[model samples]
Target: MIDTKELIDSGDLELYVCGALPANRAQEIAQISKQHPEVLEEIISIENAYQRLAAGLAPDHNDETYAKLEAIIGAKNKVVKSPSSWSPYIGWAAAGLLLIASGYFYNANNETNEEIVQIEQQKEFLETENIEIESINSQYASTLQVLSDPETVKVNLAGQAGFESSNAVAFYNNEKNVTYIDIQGLPEVPENMVYQLWSLTLDPLTPTSLGTLPIEKESYNELLRIDNAYDTQAFGITLEEAGGADAPTLERLYTLGVIDKG
Candidate 1:
């Protein structure tokens, strides 16, 4: 027979009883108990002894004792059923909902403020662009006045016989010592060539070079500023070489005018 105390302390017997031992170890122990009947008898005897000892140590509980315990449990359940015990939980739930609403409102307000700031910035930018446009309009108005003044002498350069319908006007201001020419009616010059203006003195038929007109489709329609003042009798324009003209090319004169520089 195996000592029960020694077998339990071996750890192997405890693992075997708990079904935690390896299959090989369990088979070995089973084979030994089968071959030695004394080991199996001792195992059965130890189990029966433990069961009997547990039954003897338990305290006796009568029906009257159980009834009293059940009554106490039923009373505790009645207290838990009262509504006042649940008030704190309800308060916490309401507080959670309010916090969520406040968070949503705060985010929405921030988004609205951001949109307003962007609109204000756009308005400011548009206003600045408007001011620049207005300033440019004012400058153009002042320049137009200088070209249309009555005291300014007007010279109409009519197209020559071969080049009919090509006309231009020159506004000369003697006091300002400047001439503004409107070459809108003139045709485009051939490549590598430009239009040149001249002041002609009728007595000796002298031609003096004024200046070359800048080339572009709309430049001819705009007012041109000329440098020199004149007491000339006529104004003339011709298609000359680009840059400027040296004297006047009479054969290439496209338009001419008799100016009454009074």
Candidate 2:
């Protein structure tokens, strides 16, 4: 779409509205006029100018013609006055009905304008929201590019212990390190329950619980984001009882994966 402000500033729009342009340009102007009310208003002003010029060029009528018109109008007024005197009640009734209809039409027009304004406001709000969503999507794309770099270490976590079949993958970066968990394979956590991740160091079998995954049952992209991952060893997933787990439950170990040394 062309910029409206630029189109308006171009003198071609004025020439098009004046009907001085070629057929193609005229068609373009007509399409623009249909799309933009301001363009249509400009066209109307140009048409009114043409009308006034044509009227000014017309032949003039003399004072005798004006006198004849006045005489005819005066005669008609007297004839109308006689009937009007006899039908004062009818005239009053018609006037009352006209007032009621005018009021009704005025109110309807006001309501229609209000509805149009509300719709325009809603459209503007939706457009702004779409822009914000697009911006967030772009940022996520950049984050994915960084996470999927060839140097980033990949880990496949497989379900263990109680939940034996569920699986997930985590991509971790050491330099500019971060962890992203693609948990689509994991089943939905029950109400008030969450999946807790653990970062493990193998020598003494100690683990750092890296917080819970917020369940998004309806999201199209079900991957969860975990940040600040300058990890010492392995990755593990456990079913935490509500909110999050303060410590990993070895009995509820849903998945585990050793980080690739390479």
Please, what is the whole-model Cα lDDT of each candidate in the order they appear? 0.73, 0.74
Worst 10 residues of 2 by lDDT: 77-86
How displaced is residue 241 in candidate 1, in Å? 1.7
Which sections of candidate 1 miss by over 4 Å? Answer: 1-132
| Per-residue accuracy of model 1 over 62-167 as CA lDDT, tens digit each | 6776657768787322111112233344457777757755665666666667667767777999999999989868867865777677767888889987778678
Residue 213 accuracy (lDDT) in model 1: 82
Q: What's the residue-level lDDT of 16 in candidate 2? A: 80
Q: Against the true structure, what is each candidate's TM-score?
A: 0.50, 0.54
* Candidate 2 per-residue lDDT over residues 1-262, each given as its tens digit: 4466676777767688567789988876765676578877867887788789989998986667766776878732211111222233445677776776676676666666767776777799999999999998987896788677986778989888667768778887766667777776677788878889888889888888888877776431434566745564789988888888788988888899998796
Q: RMSD, each candidate, Å?
A: 45.9, 21.2
lDDT winner among the candidates?
2
Error of 2 at 122 (Å): 3.5
